[model samples]
Target: MPINLFKKSHSRQGAERSLYLAYYFRTPTPTNPVRYHTALVVLPSPSPIPLAAAAATCAEPQSDESESLPAPTQSSPTRARSPGRATSPLPYVTTATKFHAFNVPVNENGRGRVTWEFRVERDDPGAPNTPLRLRLVCLLFIGPLSQNVGDHKLEKILKKTNVEAKYMDEFPKYYCTNWMYEALQLLVDEKIIDPLPCSPPDFWEVGGQYADRWMAENHLQVPYDLPIPCCDRAGVALATPMGPVEEKCPDDETNGNALPN
Candidate 1:
């Protein structure tokens, strides 16, 4: 009985260890994003329109005043141009839902941040291009964390999001990496930003919140027409600066897929 009593105290003396086990086994701390979303969309088209909703098939018309408003047009100037000239372009044909809001983050940095790729088309969470975009963004933004985008954890995220693994290396080659990465490389190459230690000139020691903020504040000056520029062999912008990132590859001048790799 006395030996048994000693054994019990031996377990009780380990109470600190028990508590430690409990704490170690406790649920993981929830991660909170450093940035908050603001100003959802750029209003490529005006939203919250006053048009009357019509049901499928036959529907009754609204009141006389309801039908009096002019139809939505893109060419309608959002701002002033000349004395009588129009300022805005013709209305774009958008496939976006009217009720939804586009999410643009106030800042882009946080503790252990993750990038999820998106397409202008597939607004939903699932798509083949998202992981490629995510990995590409992570790499271009910070030179690839925890190995390549094809890593196991990345594969899991891609699988969880219903993305395909086949597209791991497939990107627009221009923006094949996505917009943020392109912006990073562009700003860096332009000498608009300083470099990060052990990282590319495009990467920042403080992450992208600073650049995102800078862009957000000054994006009005950016030429929407110049989303991506094609480079010539001398690393200069060609006459036409649109299309795939690899399109500017020196070899692309002759071969298509090799892209000067």
Candidate 2:
């Protein structure tokens, strides 16, 4: 859970807005005691932005490279791309579970990083108090649009918590919010985050500890045979652990399927 949506409508340009999927979870990392990870960031602008610039907007540590992403600077927001790469409008970037922080990188020259033709898998280590990991199978950009009032109301409960306003904005719009909600719902429907309410983002605020307590109290182990979501698209098979190591794509699928392909 901890699926909080923060909206930051382009302060000046309302249509050119950004939605952030702020995910606060506890991990074993010492430096990240209370891991406040932004699982997914949906910046559905009228056009694309530079991947480097988009990456720069994030303040949280990047868990993709096994090292922290360089901080963004006013002069040069994100890391500079190698020569021959053209910077333009960017799409969305989703950092799934820590297992493989960023399964897909933003297309340096394409519209986005992920497409609709992607698969979602839940990997259970089969350990107690251990939550299953969410994996994004495709490497393209999937944009978001609109806002969901229902979710907006539900997150009101989190206001009482110390979670800052800057953390909870009007980002992640409806499309990205719903997409992430559905993904988390899969975990709820599967009973992974059971014995604990899985609906509210507040529940997930300290979800890591909650899951640990549940595991100790019930002696439950994360099962491996979870009902996962997968799809197939012609010419684009699901990538393996070590394949497609490039950022730029020749055939862009930024505007892909709504659901899995």
Q: Per-residue lDDT for 166-186 in model 2, tens only?
A: 111232122222334454444
lDDT digits (tens) for residues 1-261 of candidate 1: 000000000000101000000000011123322131111011121111111122111112223442232211233223331211112121222121111112222333553322333322212111112211111111011111222222233223322222222132332121212333333344335443333232321222122222232233332111221121111111111111111121122221121121101
Please give the clash total of every predicted structure, in order.
9, 18
Give candidate 1's total backbone clashes: 9
The lDDT of model 2 is 0.25
Q: Which 10 consecutive residues of model 1 have the lowest summed lDDT?
A: 16-25
